[model samples]
Target: MSEMVSHSYPRVALIGECMIELQQHANGTLKQSFGGDTLNTAVYLSRLLGSAAQVDYVTALGDDSFSDAMCQVWTDEGIGLSRVQRLPGRLPGLYCIQTDASGERRFLYWRNEAAVRECFTTPAAEPVLAALPDYDVLYFSGITLAVLGETGRARLLSTLGDARDRGARVVFDNNYRPRLWRSVEQARQAYRAVMHEVDLALLTEEDEQALFDYSDGEQILQTYRAMGVSEVVVKRGAQSCLVSVDDRRYEVPAHTVQKVIDTTAAGDSFSAAYLARRLRGGSPKDAADAGHQLASLVIQHPGALIPRSVMPV
Candidate 1:
């Protein structure tokens, strides 16, 4: 495989929500931390890139202590926070995770009134939206679309178009949550609206099936190709990850894990590593390998983030 040309010190911005995360144990105890899909990717991407690139997170949060703690964590991880908005009299979302013995997870959320729902709709958001197009890369997920509501989604779509027009790459992760939308058709509409603006799509086979009722991976790839997406990666848990770049296809095998603990942030971490490797000029196969390796390590831990000391060298 040919290596992608490396870009110099790319500035990346990830847009989404970060919530107060609670890990519910079998003994009825709860462990509190902060996590969200885009935020998790931002943290991992910053750690992987270090001084090689700039990674920033764009979202709205309340002035609560939880929000304070979240900002501190992001700051310590080397993620830029110049675009974060603090809204008064509001709070971030909250979610509780329950993990099965096999490391599968179920989430219970109380986020309908989260401050991020107004992320791109607030009066203060005009400057943030105006600044997004200046970045080298913009990243967001299906959950971001769902949470943004109609007004916020419209603004985000416009910003994405402007970003692409200004020569920025737009990376999208199809992390679909059925309950987040009022109906399947609504979710499909929102997804299709943003698909055209996406440059690279990191998708899960299961999410594609559940969201679009596609029969197989080929259908998914064909659909993306038809939509003019330049590069696409399909991640299948414990199986090979399929990559389609410049009309060339490759399947990279996932690393084996003997024991699984928590599956939280598995795909998020994978996407981060894949993007980081690609930014460093790795081939698609090499990037997928990096993704699988990091995802394997992340699942062995208990939360969205593992201790920095255990990061692979």
Candidate 2:
């Protein structure tokens, strides 16, 4: 209800792995970049907010060449790296995105050995965990939890509880990866526990359906609301996205794009812009529109991150 730009921007942290992304084109050439759901969101959120907000990435990467390149990209994008850790000999995950003529994407992952798996359990993680409560906003995803293993997930959940108690808004993006878990029941338990601490939730309708077998998006909305989430957003790809806060619900359509080169990070960027707008005091509807606009443009490009020169201001 207040003007977003009127107040000082808040600090936001996004936690997840930044994997080595390989995109293969029809011409047999491969494009290289670093991407992960939360990292992608952090980059776009930083780009959208600029100096208005402080954006930091929270993850662990290897001290290898690929990880070095990844950090360089993040630094150049103006993303803070204070919370990012480097483990010796451990490497980041690798994933390749293959798209068909219809712009549909298929992912092949090799992330079982990523350094982020121990991100929350390392002796060095104590300080990071303690400092989390100081952030204005803490953002993470299903993948963030899954990659951490059970002990790490428990630690993270504890931090989320503590952070929420400190008046920091905990935002969750349900980027569920079925293969990451041993079984559906295990994932449901983990997500349900963390869901209780989430103030803002960005959920993809499809992922919810896949993970929880929700009859529809409306059921998913009701489920999150029952779990005490203050605001729940449902993203339906090229379709409309729904937002609900308490008893009120708003339906907003996604931007219609004539072309979609790759869908890599569309939801991730959308979440970033939405949170950035909300942190700056923009209304929920305005934030959703900003999200859709950014995602539409992102899909028109080839990778999770577009060139900074072409980024939205």
Per-model CA lDDT versus the true structure: 0.92, 0.89
Listed per model in order, the count of residue pairs whose N, CA or C atoms clash below 3 Å is: 0, 1
lDDT (tens digit, per residue) of candidate 2 on 200-285: 99999999999999988799889899999989999999998998876788888999999778788999999988888888777888
Candidate 2 residues lying further than 4 Å off, grouped into runs, are 1-7, 25-29, 99-105
Shift of residue 172 alpha carbon in model 2, Å: 0.3
With a 3 Å backbone cut-off (N, CA, C), the pairs that clash in candidate 2 are 4-280
For candidate 1, list the clashing residue pairs, or say none. Answer: none
For this target, which candidate reaches the highest TM-score against the unseen true structure?
A: 1
Where's the lowest-lDDT run of ten residues in candidate 2?
Answer: 1-10
Weakest 10 consecutive residues of candidate 1 by summed lDDT:
1-10
